[model samples]
Target chain A: MINEGCRLMVVDDELIVCKRLKQILEKAGYDVTVFNNGEDAVKKLELESYDIIVTDLKMEGVDGMKILETAKRKNPDTRVIMITGFAETETAREAFRKGVFDFISKPVEIDTIKQVIIKAQKEISGSKT
Target chain B: MRLRIWHKMIIGMAIPSFIALLGVLLSYGYIDDVQKRHGYEQIADNINDHVLEVRQNENYFFHFKNGRFLDKLHKAILDLKNSVNKISSYTVEEIGKEDFALLQDAIRTYPPLINDLYDNYLEETNVTEKVRAEGRKLESFVAEKNRTSELTSSFILHLRLLEKNYMLFRNEKSFNALNSKLTEMKKLTPHCFECNPYIEAIHNLFETYKKSDALVAEIQLTGDRLEEITRRMAQRERQRIGSFLTKTKLLLAAALVLLSTLGPLFVYKTATYIVAPIIRLAEITKKISEGNMTLRAPLREHDETYFLATSFNTMLDKLQLTYNSLERSIELLNEKQAQLVDSEKRASIGLLVAGVAHELNNPLYNISLTVDAMKDELNELTEEKISEYIEDISSQSKRAHDIIDNLLDFARARKSTEMEKQNIVRIVKESFNLVANQMRINNIKLEQDLPDEPLFIKGNHSKLEQILVSILTNAIQAMKGNGTLRVSLRPDPESNRIVLKISDNGQGIPEEEIRNIFEPFFTTKPVGQGTGLGLSVCRSLVREHNGEIEVESKLGEGTTVTLKFPQYKENA
Candidate 1:
């Protein structure tokens, strides 16, 4: 699959997270939209859907689980990757059950999430074929 | 009714006192009777004395036949009458009034008899004088007649001798001879007129003597009767006095015997009443102090001892309760001591590990990513972009370093229990950092109501952090997925302590279980989920800081755990 213009959404309450993750994934030629908070991400998910959603699992309000829930419900093919500093097993299991593509713990390794997103892009392309 | 010791003592003493009083009253009555008898005896004695005086005066009147003696006898009779009159009705009842009346009758007759005797005596004296005159005339006549004739004179002389014999002897033979001689004299001197006069005088004197004898006999009889009455009265009064003294002595003796018997009886009874229960209570006290807390005082009479027993029982109950609670406290202390060690390690690792992992991993991941990104773009990246990446790397590394440093300090809390004056605001904030991620992940909303100024409190910083972290962990867990948690700090003006409140709008504790929330091993969480030592450890640590922890909750509302930490004093 060519990494030409795969649509991606990044949601994290940390500005550093959104900033760094957006910089990394956009440099990899993925069309990425970033939100520093989950509320805005959820608001955006209402109007638009992405092929892949990268979100931090914990936020002040409308956290990663809500984003995951919204993204998957809007489009089943949309691959949602969960990132969090708190890697609680139960939350991870719940995210998996909600069909999150992958769960990563913070401070996120840019390559790992990039690889997961690249894989999501391939799957998107493959599912389209 | 509860009789106090003093009341019982008064009652115990009063019984004997009353008996003694009764005895005294009874003795007083007997003594009064004796005294009445004594008064009667004195009156009888007075009457007897008066009768003696009358008898003495009457005897003197009989012997001397004088008007003075007669007057004395009359006065004595009056005195006797007066003394007899002085006898009271009450005295008459004690000593029979029959004797007294007899005495009065005797006195009345005796005085008159004595006066009659005196009058007879005077008449006898006049008759004697007349006889002397007549005798002298006869003697002169006889002398003249007899001088003329010798034979006649001899006969007259013989008759005169016979008269002398009659006067001297006063016998029957003498009196007959005198009579015959008188006849002869009268026949011989039939012509003598003086002899007739002498004979008449002799007859008058004899008549007066006979009347005097009769009156004397009557007077003697009456006087003897008065003396008898008086003597009888005196003897009877003496007897009565003796009997009264004997009776009074008997009454006192009886009272003494009764008092001696009953006084000791009452004393023993009262002593037993008071001492027996007290001894029992003392024994119970000894036993209880010896650790037989089960022992209780027995209820006895409804007196002071009874009240003592009841209060003693109540005290025993309270002591037993305190003893049981103390035993339970010791048990809890032992278990809590064990929990303290386990939870200190468990909780620090439990709360801190997740916290350290998240906080540390966030910066660590950022630094790694930025470094990896810089490494991956080393060939194609612009110097401007590279410098920007380098700056991000440096900042992210510092963030990572700070998370590790905070974690190191948290871990150091367990080893160093040294307390220092620390700002509670900083403690609250740093401790919250450990659980802030957890709260966020659980979608718990926080409302901070903290003072802007630093709230200084003397405490072990790490321990304070552990307290806050564990409590926050509990609040976050209770909220489960979503809830509002309010953390507030204020300097309580009243207690001069820093008050930290952590309240959650989560599943509030049940009312019944709330009391046990701080109890070690008491947990509402399912088995194996919670070691149940969290709040208990928090409570002890709060206590160590000389602070208090209180939980207020309503079922289905929320739980607010308020902690008070002693404010740090600069001089302290």
Candidate 2:
């Protein structure tokens, strides 16, 4: 079972995607907060510390890359994951260069996303130890 | 004489020489007249001296029978004889027979008469007493005869002396007399000799006295005859000189007329041949200055003027070439400017469509999600009364979802990839299926003329489908109410292209607005009903596949949009 107090932040322009991801992650026994856009996620990251961050790459306002940059700066120990609808090699490379834990392309398979989050959680926990 | 320019100049100089020639003729006439008069005077003087010696010989015989005066008279007689001989000698040298005869008679008769008178005086002085009385009587007779001879001799001497003086005066006075009488003669008779003929009569009277008064008068008469002949010859010479002068004047006047007329003629011909062409060239140059390139100077000759004309024509040709190229360049620049404006219009329309699509996305998504949740909730309710409600909810949700999907699809960014061969018929069927419910709701009758066999095209599948869907949707929208929509897909064998013809029997596009149908954001539909990018996107997509899309329509008639896609070739 996943740790109960482990916190995760989900950022996306699509409110449904963010809510769905948060609900799925919560059901997996992780504490989760959902943000409709990257700007809101960055504001929340300033106040509270998180174990992992998952964000969409393309959005209306601030995007996933900005959230990744801000989250890594605020808490270097936090693990970040990037999700995109379009599979572009340049975006994946950029995300890797930013030291994110994983990069994902959507129509996300739920199992693969679950596994990647679990891996990020394990990394965050290990860092805490 | 060769009449060169210098010859003409010399002839011009002869005009003044002609005046000098007249003066020379006048002086020559005067000198000749003076020489004739002087010769007559010399002959008269010699005759007068001979008469004086004869008178002195008679006086000495009358006074002293054997005196020195007698001897002097005889010697004077001898001297007169010698003078007569000398006159004869002068006459013979001059070949004058009249002067020679006169001198020989004077020498023979005068010397004999003087010897007879001297013998009579000597015989009277030597006579005896008885014959003295007889000799005295004879002496008386001889004395009377001697006195008569002396009287005649003295009178003759006076007449000779007068003749000599007259000849001397005639020689000295003839010129002055002629001059003085000229004015009087002009008033009275217009001829000097006629008005004052007495002067010539006095000269003739002296000439006759010179013949009669002295022993040498015969010599003087010869001289008078000579003078008369010389004067007549001088008159002939003067007449000839005057006629010559008149002829010379007439010739000079004729020559002047000829020169005056001919000189200007020569000058005028030369000017026409040489200077006129130069003047014409200058006029053409002036026209060029005024910017008249079309003015072509006539080429009149094959010389420098002709060459100049050719050169000018060449220059005009060059100018026209430059002007034509400049016009072409300007036309190209205008075309480029129009293209830039068209591209900017497309860019702006694309941005606006993207903005509107983005703004609509969120609300549409929210509505779709709400409908989906309601449908899910309705499905769980267990009541027969709610079964119909669930069905209605499901149907409405599905409708809303479809609308949202259509909007998103229309707003999606179209990035074309490389082309591939695909079945054109299947792509069209799929596109129709995507909008089938909408077509049914509009009650539009759709007609299809699809080929029996599979028709393949070299094109991007998604883009081709999108193009077909957009055209079909536009055709449906144009019909609005119930109308027929016809689609014909056929292969153009000659061009090797597949032609997709979509025509609608509805309100037709206006002629003025038909050209703008493919322009982005140019639409007649109400806002939110048409995005205006449908036809523009179709055209772009067709172009990407190395194909063309065109439309033909008329007001109140229908529009037909034809898409021609290059046929697929497996080998290619």
Candidate 1 - chain A - TM: 0.94
Local distance difference test, candidate 1? 0.79
**lDDT tens readout by residue for model 2, B105-173:** 555565555455455444333322223343234334434565533223343333334434543453435
Instruction: Classify candidate 1 by CAPRI docking class.
Output: acceptable
The backbone clash count of each candidate, in order, is: 3, 0
Please tell me what DockQ candidate 1 reaches. Answer: 0.38
Going through the candidates in order, their DockQ values are 0.38, 0.03
Which segments of model 2 are wrong by more than 4 Å? A1-44, A47-64, A72-89, A96-129, B1-265, B278-572
Candidate 2 positional error at B452, Å: 68
TM-scores, all candidates, are 0.50, 0.28
**Candidate 2 clashing pairs, residues 3+ apart or interchain:** none
* Fnat of each prediction, in sequence: 0.67, 0.02
